[model samples]
Target: MTSTPPSPDAISYFGIEVPFMQHIGLRPLLLDSDRCHTLLAMRPDIVNSRGDIHGGTLMSAFDFTLSGAARAHDPERLGVITVDMTTHFYEPARTDLTVIGRCTRRGRSLAFCEGEIVDTAGTVVAVARAVFKLVVRQPA
Candidate 1:
């Protein structure tokens, strides 16, 4: 996918409102509206017993970032709910991590996305493929 760099303020999505994402230090680095890039710092509170970033933490970040990708088609007017996700852990993320997600295909109802988590040195730690159902955003 091609993208221009995004400013910190450029990211504005429901994922940022997620309490768990916030608790885990998942920060949106970019979301040029079609692709989502996120950062998570490795900290004691967010690690597994082995002292590496936990799989659940990685999965949560992917879910939020991938959902952002699905919603990017029409963000303000669109919403998404996860239909399914398949994730694979490749290694223990021992340092800060970045996740990037992009929509591979989008149909009228379902959008498919793929994402990966990489370390500061660009080693991939995990990957996830997901499907999300598009919905209209209801007025608050």
Candidate 2:
């Protein structure tokens, strides 16, 4: 039987809890075997001096979202550490946004992932691709 999908707030978006991510206000929206979707509500804290969303905030969201996708296969049993990421900015983000991440390819010890950020009006804000090294999560 197909289980009920989880509500946004019910999910542990990062797989592993990360205080910094929490502080950044990234919230889990959806997670699947090969993809993850997350939300980032615009806040004063993430805004740059010029009043646009800071690029660093976008990058961090990409890192966390892509990592989540890379480990989505078995989040509770696996973890991923980012090896590298490249991001391109297409527009200045001025509002809340959604990040969609996909694991493009998976190997025994590494995974390739990509992510896109779109603002509330559906404008493309940024896109990123990354590599992550997979590791077994040790019992805490």
Candidate 3:
């Protein structure tokens, strides 16, 4: 399944507004056959008390990005429920960041993906792996 990178105006899986993407400072960096990745320019407002990008924010981004990847593989109308997720925080992200999620394996009913969050300088900040239960809509 060959996929092309979506334009900036392309709609995201979360149904996020294009302006909101800019507001959140996330740009769709790359979209490939089995992956959709985004880069986020971290803002102080999204940082934690320790001055690091909050873990929850990273997790949210990870989930969103992976779901995008899954959808790319199967555009059939469906919702993804994250059955399980595990994240490892390697280092703190203080500035601009990049989050990449790639579908490692896809099944008829489930998809597995892994993602990483890195600082602008290319240091790993966090890593996450998730399994999503893909629910396909049936004809009414």
Q: For candidate 2, write residues 1-140 as lDDT tens digits.
A: 45455455553655656657778899889888999999999999999999998999999999999999999998889988899999999999899999999999999999999989999998899999999999998766
Q: For candidate 3, lDDT tens digit of each residue in 43-135?
A: 887789998877877887787778767666654566688888899998988888888888899898899999888787889889999998888
Tell me the RMSD of model 2 versus the true structure. 6.4
TM-score for candidate 1? 0.87
Give lDDT: candidate 2, residue 108.
98
lDDT by residue (tens digit), candidate 1, 9-94: 44345433555677788888877667988899989999888999889989999999999888886877888899999999998899
Worst lDDT 10-window in candidate 1 = 7-16
Clashing pairs in 3: none
Q: In candidate 1, how many clashes are counted?
A: 0
The models' CA-based lDDT, in order, is 0.86, 0.90, 0.77
TM of each candidate vs. truth: 0.87, 0.90, 0.77
Candidates by TM-score, descending order: 2, 1, 3
Listing every candidate in turn, what is its Cα RMSD in Å to the true structure after a full C-alpha superposition?
7.4, 6.4, 6.6
Winning candidate number (lDDT): 2
Candidate achieving higher TM-score, 1 or 3: 1
> Local error of candidate 3 at 67, Å?
1.7
Residue-pair clashes per candidate: 0, 0, 0
